[model samples]
Target: MASVALAGCGKSNDAAKPVAAAGAVEKPTLKLGFIKLTDMAPLAIAKEKGFFQEEGLNVTLEPQANWKVLLDGVAGGTLDGAHMLAGQPIAAAAGIGAKAKLIAPLSLDLNGNAITVSNKVWTAIAAKLPKGPDGKVAHPISAAALKGMPLKFGMVFPFSPHNYELRYWLAAGGIQPGFYLPGDLAGTTGAQMQISVTPPPQMPSTLEAGTIDGYSVGEPWNQAAVKKKIGVPVITDAEIFPDNPEKVFGMTEDFAKKNPKTVQALLRALIKAQQWLDAEGGKNRAEAVKILAKSQYVGADPEVIAASMTGKFTFAPGDAREAPGFNIFFDKFAGYPYYSDAVWFLTQMRRWGQIPTDKTDQWYADTAKAVYKPDLYLAAAKSLVDQGVIPAAAVPETDGYKAPQGGFIDGVTYDGKQPNAYLAKFTIGLKAGQTVTPAGVK
Candidate 1:
């Protein structure tokens, strides 16, 4: 177990910390699940830093094998909640995979993923990349460099930000990333580059073995590639989709309903953990990297974990660069569970034929609302504000939808309010009324 020290506020040394409201913690002991990823820092920090204890709850943080097993643990009631892919709750609510009613009241972090290519692919494209004034390769490299090449890429899971971001980057570069059809879950119906699943920790080893030419995954794995001199990270998710929602704190609706107060207590601790992470421009991140490097957590070398966590990322040897927003926790209102974020994932699911059929804009909105519970998020935030644990300004004033924004690599605008129109704007991918079949898109 890691030791986390609590920071002091402006109050007197003798001043006692504020306690939770009467009966705010319905369940005193809880078990949470998480995969071994740097983005899982918030959960580990909350447990180690005594935030959960402050809320009158005891949390046992367990590391699961993969996303599927973690989701299963949450849905089957073995875990009170877990660090989950943003799409897990959305996919579950949409009945695309697991048949459970899961809801996300909190988003874990944003922009911790990157696309890395093996040494062979890097060698092929490095000479062709445009040089900057420094005479080095310009960043945010387009996936067009891989065009006309027979490449197999790896993603962490089917319903993951890695998959969607990889596809978006490929399509933006005029490279077909393939699609999924009914009875054909391979997601490679029409492709320029074939993509398949590779567990996060094995990405570097898999790439070295020539099983995959490249991969899109979260931190440590990407950095591990650079450390081992096996691959170079070409583009980060932040460059692909600036400030994209990455992971969420997910639990079944039944759990949330049965233990509403317990959920509130958990959220309070998580919010505090987020604040500590982004404090002082990540002054606490070094300490966080140590915690995450523990055997029970991410269990990677602290140096590799710090590659992205401490506001810097390495593309290749001697290619370190400032990436202040690489793994955001609380800043930029990252902890808020935005309905627009959920809608964006739904759009990707539809774009790739995972949805299998076209639905009305209202259906998109309804589905987003059903899975993303901003109401619960706000309730927890308000409690923390009232208790003076966090500032009121940390919460954003909104109707649960961000205004139309354009930060994509493709230069296309996305407005959550207009789902079908957004789908239509894509040059590639299924348009309105299109369904994917095993034979091909129909």
Candidate 2:
């Protein structure tokens, strides 16, 4: 396994001692993989801040080139687990891409992605966008601004939240981002705006090269564009879908079954790292930016990473705004792996024709339950609580489902229990009886 030499970050006060004693961690030495994204903070912080070491884990953190390589590493047992897109394990269970019985026992963080457009595209649409009273473009700029324009956009991976959030943002504005046909792996059939894949770090360069007019990705790539003067961020994923689940610590089900104590130890360390990240209203973020700027981790400039990670998001030059919720690590039950979060991803999979057929609501629920092991999350959280590491309230008292949420850009409500009903409300995307074909939606 390719490993990065981590720079030292002295242990935080909260992480100085082992919080939970998961007796006899079956595996003390382990290797994990992650893409170079800001959402991978939990893993990096855990390693640098000595949280992993406190929990008796000798973990090696490696940065993969892209999401596909990271996912394949985790699924193939080359790496033990990874900072994975929330949809990866769900797609695996649904047989959408690769087939594996992967499990997401804990969610990593929330709301760290944004959609950015090239400067040329932004200049074209800026003149038409209505301005608010402050003489700036009104917030939550809709995809309608690009209507009737033939454009191509990039996302990190087929099963990435970036893809679904971009599609959701576009479809909400009366544009069809396209669907996956039975034989069409590109998923551009019937597309009004073509969407394709690009690695996260390459987004800015890809946009600058004119290969894609825009892209949806996690920081600091979006921030990198604004810094490099290559593109302008139009909208954040939080604006598209509020407090949405993003990345999760994913591993094969077999690994979890065989090494239960090790899994709990890993989760405990990650939870501590998350709490440290969000501590004291983000006072620690400056230091975190420096740590993540190391070549082994995010490797972006601290200023660029801080643009989003330190409670502000920059849309364009001179348009920075306070965005405290831009990158939520531990607050508001961020670590708990909710089954509802998994169900929502499954619904999007079916919505975009990745599943290729209609599935009963029960199927969605069963699939979510199979892939999202909230029982394990609770067990890990409980251990921390018992040790007074975290407040009991920090652990959400949820029934594996969030209340029906309605902060969507389009004002459509999403109830995890009613995925089909929620999906049917979309003006675009496949309907209940419809399926994707090379010709068109059938």
Candidate 3:
């Protein structure tokens, strides 16, 4: 089965010839799932650019109703894998939401999400916000600006970057986003502003209908709001936590074990797609946005998708800014599943009371190592490097933990090796002996 790469992808037909290296895989056919968000670009690119086919894979990309369905599809074997929240596998491994032995072999993307407020909310707080030198509202508008107002925000999933970023932004500005008791799934206990779950595609409409005053989600949904004039994105996830891990290519641990070769093929194809996405300084993004705008994929207008995908992000109708790193697929080691990245998500889960009890730093590290399979990822990456498909420097060399990182909006540094100490620094979350209750943090 021979196919040419998509136009503007800057690849020859020979690009797909690396599949022979994978040998005969145990499973050649795959059914992968994704939500309708822009960060799912690598999956679309893999299928559209025939990277999957090139890697001896017959892959079917299905759009799921929501994150839960996508997660269940993978855990239940309906989907071999999925474009999942980074926290999904970590949560699953920790028995938080759905208890299953899931693992993230590859990270899908970084920093493609943003927090948007309804036009009503924006209008109410716009004048109070300080302006930049460019005579526009200053960027990274603090959540403190909306502190006194009664607001309800939406996130795609409870264990999602959207939820944690929204909470981090709010808590940084001294507003309690709340805690999750063992039975309290709502996570609104002691919250100044209520945050709840709403599917990604419904976020814009939900804001327009005034059902929720604001939301945190991946693009082009946030950009869709700007296009529809329904809401304005105040801050991006990159602004909240720079180069933060967003989504991952996740499957059940059993599936990975049973299909090691097949998993390598999948990772190889996906890594190629990611490289193409960030190639030539994002020269392929226009075609990527066009592919994502199709009915079966993201199903949004090309203009809307391009609003965030093509080197710039639209905060409002006229408020576009250069954000070259917004939807990074492979650049800056985006595809590498760092154990420290896993540990960061685990820290947030514990900080929000999703774990419901204290966990030692070593427990966090062990849990992260169990869930994030860097060995598997490195195996695939090494193959690609051996084939000269990617640069040797593309793969990061580390002992799993990243150095102390400090780009958070709150100015607090995070070290994956110090989860408990990091949790104690937060003024709004559960501390070492603290636990969540029906009343509040106890």
Candidate 4:
């Protein structure tokens, strides 16, 4: 992380003031929450590297016990803002987990998550894996080969994109990714399907102890397994979804309404942090890894974090290989938060039954409008372009990235404008306007 001095920020009326309401004042202090995962690097990089201070904002980075705690903190005003799962803001806005208007004006980074399988499970699947003409394991190692025995797959949480990403990869490979029934919120006891949730850092141990056959989680846990020689990374989300949105820097709706300018300024600092990370052909990655490995932060080894952060991936011990863009931070088209990214999460939420009722495509649009504020993000980008922090042409059309997003490896086109039509394309899960009134669902 870059060095930053945390000092009290005084409000400035001349800073373009976002396109929000007039005369919005800067926040006096910001209490930001994050779980210990590498995807939150932008936040850590902002604070440790002084990007926050450069924005004339005084910010405190707090670590929460888990995603739920971090979210509750933000919702209850215990936290001013936090790093969150890409789906958290959408889920909250759509009334899935906790009802609220959650806005992510900035996307932290992308492609940092990977699916890991235990050594035993890896061998079991690899044995049946069809070898390529070059004698290499073929892409998308499937679960159809391991169906003979029962196995518990793990996810970070049911509401987590980690869960959906894992589920998506499994289903794509001809395996059943279990969906929790509506209001079945307690735990996943009997998931006969291929994937489920385990906390990210614990993913390695859970697989090692045979509690689960495999898991999908963010670094450095996936790489940690390779460091420990306990498991092999099966596939990355980058492969499954292709630059799929992984994490976002989220703020509560109340915060946005009350402190819109503060939100934009905060976004400005985060965007700068991202550009720094991607600068100089990613030469700053080693410094970023040192910060993530601090005992108070991710607390993983620098080399382990590097395995993914620096674009090198290790599936198993002594099995390290070059996998560039494995963990993107501070660069690429990584900073802009897209509305279509919001729609994808909504589609997955509905697919897995977290979204109980059938919603129309218009409803999807309205819900997306309520969160994923690219308008605010554009304000920051404009500011960066003016400040010479970023080039203007590098910005993708912020109008929307969802237009027939057919580039998914599965060849399914997802146009956020027609979510219901997109939902119907899936062979699995309840389609639009469809409901599974499972057992006691009311």
Candidate 4 C-alpha RMSD relative to the actual structure: 5.2
The lDDT of each candidate is 0.89, 0.90, 0.89, 0.74
Task: Residues 1-442, candidate 3: write the lDDT tens digits.
Answer: 0111222233444464444445588888789999999999999888888788777888899999999999999999999999999989999888886778999999999899999999889999999999999999998889989989989999999999999999999999889989988677989888899999999999999999999999999998999999889899999999999999999999999999998989998998899899888887887788988899999999999999999998898998878999988988888888999999999998998888888999988999999999999999999989888877788888899998889999899989999899888888888888899888888877
Model 3 regions lying over 4 Å from their true place:
1-18, 21-23
Lowest summed lDDT over 10 consecutive residues: which window, candidate 3? 1-10
lDDT of 2 by residue, 319-395 (tens): 99889999998898889888889999998888899989999999999999988998998998898787777778788
> Over the stretch 1-442, how does candidate 1's per-residue lDDT look in tens digits?
1122234322221342436665667777899999899999989888777777777777899989888899899999999999999999999988897889999999999899999999999999999999999888998899988889999999999999999999999999999888887666879988888999998998999999999999999999999999999999999999999999999999999999989989998998898888888887777889899989999999999999988888788998888999999998888889998888999999999999899899899998999999999989899989888777777778899999998978899999999999999999999999987887767678
Clashes of each: 0, 0, 0, 9
Model 4, span 1-442: residue lDDT tens: 2222222221132332233233343684688998889888878777776667666677888888878888888888899999898888888888876766778888888788888888887877787788767566766565566565677777887667788777776666565555556455632323346455566777888888888888888999988888888988878777777677888898887888888778877887787677767766677788889989997789998988988887677766655556677766544567777777888889888876777688877788888878888888888878777776677764667476645655464667778777888888877666656654544223
Candidate 3: residue pairs that collide: none
**In model 2, what is the error at residue 320, expressed in angstroms?**
0.4
lDDT of 3 at 137: 93
Which regions of candidate 1 are displaced past 4 Å?
A: 1-18, 21-24
On the 0 to 100 scale, the lDDT of residue 241 in model 3 is 95
- Number of clashes in model 3? 0
